[model samples]
Target: MCSSFRSLLPALRAFTAKCPPPQICTSLRTYATEAVPDFEHKPSHYGQPLFQSHPHLLRPHELTPGIPSEEYERRRKDLMDSLPSNSVVVLIAAPVKYMSGSIYKYRQGSDFWYLTGFEEPDSAVVLEKNASSRGYRMTLFSNGKDSAKEKWDGPRTGFDDALNFFKADDALTIKAFPAQLRSMISLYSNVYIDLPQSPRKNARSTKSLLRYLSPPVNPRSEYETVVESLSSSRRKPLAPHIAQLRAFKSVCEQQVMRMAADISGRSHAKTMRFTRPGISESALAAHFEYLCSLSGSQRLAYVPVVASGPNALIIHYTSNNQVVQDGEMILMDAGCEYNGYASDITRTYPANGSFTPPQRELYSAVLSAQKALVGLCTEAEGLSLHDLHRKSCDFLRRELKQIGFTLHTGDLERVLYPHFLSHPIGIDLHESSYSDRGESLKAGMVITVEPGIYVPPTAQFPKHFHNFGIRIEDEVLVGEKHPVVLSVSAPKEIADIEGACQGLLGLEPI
Candidate 1:
């Protein structure tokens, strides 16, 4: 054997020793004993697509589409560097969700994916700060290679490839993770973990690590269990630390987000042209999704709100079964997910090719308020989401009063504008949920500026504006001087929207 292969024999033997079953031990040993060149050239498969195999979807050295492996490494290093010495961070992957026997599409947990960039279910990673060195060590516990399982489901990264391809210092079968975590628990002074909560509704699958962690009685969480076992260590919530890191986007991340926005924006414009009187909302929603897929979106960001007429008055209305009427407005709040990033854009337009005077008046009011809120997204403005929301309420109140809808002192925020002005957007549609809305804006942050006015059919309101709802939303990236509107391709102006509906404004195919 070569010297390099000979040196790895000891660690390989140690890994094999941890295998729970004789068959698993044999499988792991076979990969470890193979020649390095043969292993490199073999037709091995991964849990997720890799650059070498899926070059059409990925560039060289990319772990995921549009994100290089080095960037994932830097994210891990940055997370560990922020923690105290002799710290250990544990992150668990999202479990595969099922509806009956069929499986829902798997999406990796955002925080876990942010750090490791390993896209597999039923896996966990531990980042141990080197007690005597400068850097940290990453250990991945993943599924062992099994021919029977591979034939049925798909290939796994397995132990040896986890070390070689994913840059993990050590790799072990997931069966050994509980024992390994217990052994390391006493050594670290600080433990940071983001544990999956105990399922309150449907129980998790037996293969899930979450099910393994969940106890039968009292239903204590994984976090609670880990905290109770620690005698001398300080336990910290891992989410806030990761959220702070995720709040600011890297240059490559910004590029991917811009691509996501463009895809969704163009899809929205196409949907606008397809809308017409007597069209069912559900059909319109399906057509929008079709356009997004044709333009390279992997999936819709969320269940789109394709509301028309009275349905538009209900915020978060997703029961898209109503047929649009000629003079009524259609409010379509939709976006797409591209390369793990999310884009959100909402536009309200007349079902017919032209808006009624009442509809145009309300649409203009919402659009003006939305523009003002987007302007405040810059770092120079130094405004928080709460501040911007207050500004939105003020802008809409004045605009509505000019349009003949007077509001009482607290009626504007309490009734008219029911939703917040902005939310951060990234890997998840609502990214960094733990982040503070009161915090000032930063240059690398991305948020949505959505403003709306929902009027009920009450005697206090003008009859022309009764039951009229109008909103305009766009994704904005905070900049040093001016905010960049990422979803600018989705037309929101009265003239442009009408032009798009009439198919005359040169709406380019995405």
Candidate 2:
């Protein structure tokens, strides 16, 4: 080590030792010993870092434009053909929110990113789908600059680069969106807008896009919320045409998602080696991001959940405080983003060396259910996400009964098991896709089959089961031949996990 690095080594070791051992970190807790090659004993750079994919995996899409602008022309033609001849479709990038007063993080809307690869915020895209394919054109509207703001926040792509680099037909200052919207709608008979399903301040772009279209517009929200509650502040309705376009993933999209899942697998394994009792949950979160950085991921797909103990019961827990308990299980629900695609994975494991009986039982129940459901991802026949979820729920119901717990006879499905077992996981954790009553399974789709059993902190259950919540999640690619478990590097078997913990205890971070 260099003189400075050598002197700082003690301090770094002290800091890492105080944090949870990397083996048990939420990102890597369930990774089997065999899944991660022993890198500690080897020279530092002999192999890629735990989370980094081989350079061979980083190649761009192979499909090339047949003609100079064929790809763009094809995309533009398809988009225009789907809408009315005289219609305008508007899509906006979601803005970032500050975690505190100054520090902030953000993720752009997948639909917006899919259409335009620009990563900037306060940006909106307008597609004028006109009578003739040749007449069709697209434009982007985004923020210019305020020297004071740029100095503090750093640089942005702005409108000029968006037009020249992103190749939008035209680019305009966001200040002109209102005037442009009014002008565009006057000439067009129909208007389309892409709006989020939730209430958002930055979603004002959707509202602005829709209101300018016309007086009467689509009234349905695009997001699924908590069981029965509806947000009064939900964004303006979605444009059907735009949604229809998003239903199918482009070849480039599938490649990006595949790469994201690959990187996430490594990150999860790296995190597994970092976990131990007495470590703060926040440090684990930091460890997750660190692995993502070590790899080529752009950012986290969503707010990472590093919940430990009873905090794990809170499904969306993001406050990663509290010292991990020796025997308690930590539930981490996290994802990594590359380019713009996302990969989500969740795993629950003991903070100590292994799981207790109750934890094992609950975990095994979820694991069996997940396995049974994922087995359906075969070329011969397969189930849809919602169908698999329902199957998992049925399995959970049976398992609960087998364990002397009965539902519905006493209103079980609703009271005991309330949440759905699976969801689409992509650019969004609860990503966009239909799964309500009768959606069918489709190939080339990505989804998460996460079956969780939440035994609340109540006395109705045994003390051993009280406050214990376990969820095992894997990112899966629905394939024609078989379902690909993208996060396969993480171990789910009880024996494998226990053995991994036993071996990794007291080890230093590699």
Candidate 3:
């Protein structure tokens, strides 16, 4: 307790004398509290539905319907893990399209939505990983909040809240995206992106952030331009990597796909019951779309093909304007999109509620082949799509021969079965279009099994069966032991289809 304590007492007394009093301190506290910005006042709406705003449509942790935020995070992590160190992944959002002055409905790009689940346009994401860190950093670039713009269009999840809302490491206004991307390209050793060429005509608004990045050019695409500007060897196509990941669906994705299939299948059944001899093909198509929308589907997956009589012989016949004759058959190929998933189904039935003798015979042959092929969509079968196609050709040839029509092996494939047997299905109607169909089927992979026989009026076939076309398509999910038919609700049996057309089965609205 000695000289040290005595020396500090004078300095402590001087410091206490200079400090503010209690009242002054209180005033200082009040001023500081008032100076801090208020962060609790959030916007009443956002570009997409949130659990807080739309509790009925979303759960607490879900980013999109049936897809949780954690899954999206995992997807990003998986992609980063696949790439080497010091690599960057760039993804762009889909731009809003306009037909004249009216705006068409907006849809996010499939690969972009698969990773971030952000449904807004004029946005982009950059994911970066360095050798020193085990994890990647996600930066989201979006529009900043503007009261004037928000008044005209709906609310936006501006850059200020994007970090927390989207679980991004950093967020900035989209205006800064170009500079940021250029900096990332210079710093990172590898760049993974997929930017297609933009069309010269029908350019987007000048104010759009994406339009600013990629202006309408003549021959080179946005990708080509980037490659020419930067080191082409350092850039890699990102789609094939993402496509491999999306090929096998998670459990939640499977559930969403099943719901999509159910909605579309039930709609097809309802359309069959509503069809009559005098109904126009266009009206039937509209009615089918109505049923799909009424039963929770967001929109049609693609343009529907509602063909009657000889029109069925033409593949991809979408001009549904013809009138149905009493004796002719109606072939409808349609599907619906639910949430982000899609479902495809096809059903051909008699317009007059009864098939002629030739119609039944041809339909039975195609139905038998389709049923057998669907069973092959299993891991245990160890068959690729090409294998199924060959098997289908054999089945059709035998069935046609049994039906009193002699067809050579080459004639069956060249003339009758023109299209491939199956294709992958998920987010887009033709999901992973670049994937090899020769690869063997794996569990959790969903695909379509379609078999059709189109007989034109020629000397090789009998007159009764001429001008008859029949097709049966269904969605199948490959399983470990057995295949699950997602579109089983749409009746395929001869008796069941006939019963549905005759109104014998008491079917309810989906």
Clashing pairs in 1: none
> What is the per-residue lDDT of model 3 for residues 1-510, given as tens digits with 9 covering 90 to 100?
235644676687588679863321121112212334434434456778766555545678888877898899889888999999888998888866789988888888999999899988788899997553537999998876778888988788867567767899899877666667767777877889875544656453222324533432213243343344444577777889899999998888887788788778888888888888888999999988998887667789999999999999998999999999999988899999987999999999988778788899989989988998898889999999999998998888888889989776567888877888888999999998678889999999999999998888998887898888899999998999798888887988877687677765556433
lDDT, residue 54, model 3: 55
* Candidate 2 lDDT, 1-510, residue by residue in tens: 135544665687688678862221223212222244655533322111112221222223212111122344555567677654566676766655566576465555666665665556676787887655365778887765556656665555546545655578898876566556556655655555554444564454333433332222223231111111212332223444444455444555565566566667656555666789999999888888878766667688888999899898788899898899888898888778765567888888788857888888778877887788787855456455566666777788777767655454534445455676666665566566433324565666667778787777655555667787778888776777787776765656776465445543233233
Each model's TM-score, in the order given? 0.86, 0.71, 0.86
RMSD of candidate 1 to the truth, in angstroms, is: 14.8
Give per-residue lDDT, candidate 1, residue 443.
97
Q: What is the C-alpha RMSD of each candidate to the true structure, in Å?
A: 14.8, 12.0, 20.3
Worst lDDT run of 10 residues, candidate 1, spans 23-32
For lDDT, candidate 1 versus 3, the one ahead is 3
Span of 10 residues, lowest total lDDT, candidate 3: 24-33
CA shift at 95, candidate 2, in angstroms? 4.6
